[model samples]
Structures are given as structure tokens and as C-alpha cells.
Target: MSEKARMTTHKLFLLPDYEKEGEYLTKMHSVGWKLERVSGFSQHFVKCESENVVYKLDYAANNTNYPEYIKMFADYGWEHCGRVMGFDYFRRNADGLSEEEMEIFSDPQSKLDMMKRVILTRMTPLLIIFFMGILPNMYMIVVNSMNWDRSTLLFLAVLYLGVFALYVSIFIYCIRGFRKLKKKYTE
Candidate 1:
């Protein structure tokens, strides 16, 4: 806790992976840095004076009960850090805490429901854009191949194909993340 706060570069994940996010936060806490705030792709960390802090991230939608929801976690000893893209970040001091005591969600069913909310609220719109916008443009580029000259065609092809690849990657990521949560819970 020498300095106030510092910004460090972190690779942003488009799809939410709650467990992985917690792992990263736990790692940061282990090294003396704690999560201060999050905005878009940037995560702010501060030099913390405590160790063994466990973080929990959950897909809490932009709803009226958000404040009360946060209050509940606060009641449970989890500090309301901040929200990023409708996801709530919470952390509690795990001094002498066991593995089970570090958790926020008590059961797999609750965790599964949280992941479902993420898919319905966040990933669904991106999936729609991928299918509606990217797919149609891709189809046009492939079908009307001869109409465009080599140079113009090449540029559009590259641009649209890049978009297509990005969309596919995001879609796959969302699906895989959702399924992994589902499998972990149902088993």
C-alpha cells in the first residue's frame, strides 16, 4: 500500500467467465494488487494492505433491485466493488478462510441461473448481430463475387471476413462458456 493506485494491462475477454475472472482477481490479490474499479476493457488495481481476498463476479442485470441486490452481498461480507457491463464484482477478505467459505453462490443451481441471465441479456444481442448483419454481408460478398473488381472486392472481402471471424469467435465463446457452467451445475 505504498502508492495510491496503478493501471496495468490485462487481456479483455468478450464473454464472461465468472470462475476465470475470480481466479485472476485472486491472483492479483496474492501479489498485493486488488481490484479497484472496472470500465469497459480497463481494470484498475490498487496496492492493497491485505491478503487472501476472494473475488466473485455475477451477471447482475440493470434492474431496480440492483442496489438491494448489492446490499444483500454486503450483508454477507462481500464488498460491492463496481459493475462492468451489468456484471457485479465483489470481494471479501478470506483471512484463514477455507475453499468453500470463499464462495458467493452457495449452490450450482444458482450459478447456472446466473449464467443463463448473462446469455439472455448480453450475448443474445451480439448473436443476433452476427447472424443478421455479418452473415448477410458475407453471403452477398460470396454470391456477387464477379461484380466487384479485384481491388474493391479484396478490401470488402477482407473487411467482411474479419467481421465474420470475430463474430464467430464471440458466438463460440458465449456458447462454450454457457455450456461449461451448465455441465458443471447439472453434474
Candidate 2:
């Protein structure tokens, strides 16, 4: 027996824009690299024949009834590919299915609700840390910087600013993404 060729790629998807991640995975499958699983930021794939498929990501951080959840998706013809960091990966053959039929979400509101859940469960804690932990530390650093040497002050300034910039960027991305999704679904 021969082992199929496999590859792993690293990807970072912001919490609010997992739809893009799903699209990426679908594109990979279309190019003959089918996703086998995900671990942290690494996506593992095995070589396979090219096929038309639709991949969807759903956020459910704390689903208690694990068995039933997979069963429900199975009943709807979706294969549960894997789960990574609370995101459930599902896919189905899209060869003859309409866009409507390919959707894992049944209604616009359900999509909105999933976005909310992703925000609440995944993004919220990071935000809380930014507000409560990072902000306070930043304040203290600024206050104490007045007594520091020039070089030490410069390093701290750059480091803290970089961290602050990252948090701000994430916040902005979430706001813009949520607004776009809400408008798309609601309209």
C-alpha cells in the first residue's frame, strides 16, 4: 500500500471572518488538496481528485451534545470534517447543489446568531484582556517611563505600541466584519 501525499499549511483567520476561511478551504479542495484536519494554525491536507465541494465553518465553542450535533449535520448531508478552536468544519459535494442548498445555515438569522456566538465566545475574552489587562499595563508603563533611561524607554514604547496596535486592529476588523455580515444578512 502507498501513502497519499500530504501537506500542511499555516493560516490565521480572524474570528469575525471565518467565511473567508471556509472559502479558502473550498479552494484548496478544488485544487486537489482535501483538508483532513486542523491543529491550531496548521491545516493538514491529503492529495485527492479535484471535486466541487462547499465548505462551511460554524462556531460552537461549548456544544454539550457533541454526538447529536454531528448527527444533525449528517442528516442534512454535511460531513463533519473536523473541529479546531471551537470552529466546526463541515463540507458537502456541490456538484449539482444550488447555492441555497449548499448553505449549512438554514436562515439569515441563524448566520447572524452564529456570528454573535463567535464574538461572544472567542473574541470577547481577548477584548476583555485588552481593556482590563493591556490598557492598565500600558498606563503604568507610560507613567513609569518618565524615570527610565532613553534606550529603555524607547524599547518599551515600541513594544507596548506594537501590542496596542494589534489589539486595535483586531477590534477594527471585528467591527467592520460584523457590520458587513449584518447588512448582508438583514437586507
Candidate 3:
């Protein structure tokens, strides 16, 4: 990465939608943009000389031999790009691989298992916190707001609208992502 790197904020919750994230990164790489790092909600990219770079995301935080695991992928042409919350990002130049050969996992079942692990290990905590804590609090707020005027309710609602939207989006994404994987792998 160069010193004069540029970045943009993306709302792509890579958590259940890793394939979509990978596709987005691949598109960026193909346009001569290489992912440098992900910080906060921004995906930082550096200008690169080459296009047609492939990107992939995998759940690797659960792996005990993470170094060797990354080494294995490195041996297979994928360079370790970065990590965001245990999801490992990888990239490689599309020099010689065919269209079907660009994927990191060999089969859908393995990929499905990986996605499951992500849901259980990562999404579960988020679900617990949101449904158990945040949603109930939001409900109570709404109930309490019934005694107040519309303006007061609206004023207080602003405090958690973003958080509520985030949790809702995450829940939807997790369900859809899991279904997508299950349909492809189980059938």
C-alpha cells in the first residue's frame, strides 16, 4: 500500500454476507484498487498497478493453526489481505485461473460449514445482545413513550434508530446468508 491511500465508508456488514463482500472486493481490485485495511466502517484501499485481482473471505478465527492455515492458502496463490472481526480476507491476481477455479473452497459443503461456524460463533452473540437487551429496551421505550407526545417519542427514538436498524439488518442478513448456503450445500 502507498502512503497516499484513499478510503471510503461502505455499509457492507461482512458478517453473514461474506460472499457479497468478497465479490465487492474483487470488483474493487479489478478496477486497480487493492484493499489495504478495514478500519471502523471504512474500507481503505491503495492504488495498485494491476487489475483482475481476485478477493475471497473466509472464517479463520476458530482455526487453531491460523499461521499454517494462512500459509496453506498462500501456497495456493491467495495472499493474506486482512481481517475484520475474525473473518479473514484474501486476494490473488487472476493470472491463470479459469472462472470456476477462482473460489477458495473446493466445495459448497465446506463453505456452508464455515458459514455455520460464523453464525454460531459470531452472529449468535450479536443476536443475543440485540434481542435480549436492545430490542426489549426499545420496546419499553416505545411503551413508555405512549404516555408522552409524538414529538417526545420521536426525539427519544433517534437515540436507537440506527442501532435498531443495524440489528434488524444483521438479523435479516444472517438468515438470508444461512439460507443461501444451506440451499447450495445441502441440496
| Model number with the top lDDT | 2
What local lDDT does model 3 show for residue 120? Answer: 86
TM-score of 3: 0.78
Q: Relative to the true structure, how large is the alpha-carbon lDDT of every model?
A: 0.81, 0.89, 0.80
Q: Per-residue lDDT for 1-187 in model 3, tens only?
A: 5476576757556576778788888888777778888765568888776588888888965688888999999898889988888888888878788876688888777887787788889888888888788888788887898698888788768878878887787688778878876787778
Output the better candidate (2/3) by lDDT.
2
Specify the poorest-scoring 10-residue window by lDDT in model 3. 5-14
- Pairs with steric clashes in candidate 2: none
Per-prediction count of colliding residue pairs? 0, 0, 0
How would you encode candidate 2's per-residue C-alpha lDDT over 1-187 as one tens digit per residue? Answer: 9999999999987777689889999999999999999888889999999989889998866889999999998998999998988899999999989878899887998999998988888888888988898889889888998799999988988998999998898899888998998898899
Candidate 2 stretches with Cα past 4 Å from truth are none
What is the full ranking by lDDT, best candidate first? 2, 1, 3
Over 4 Å off in model 1, which ranges? 1-5, 98-100, 142-147
lDDT of 1: 0.81
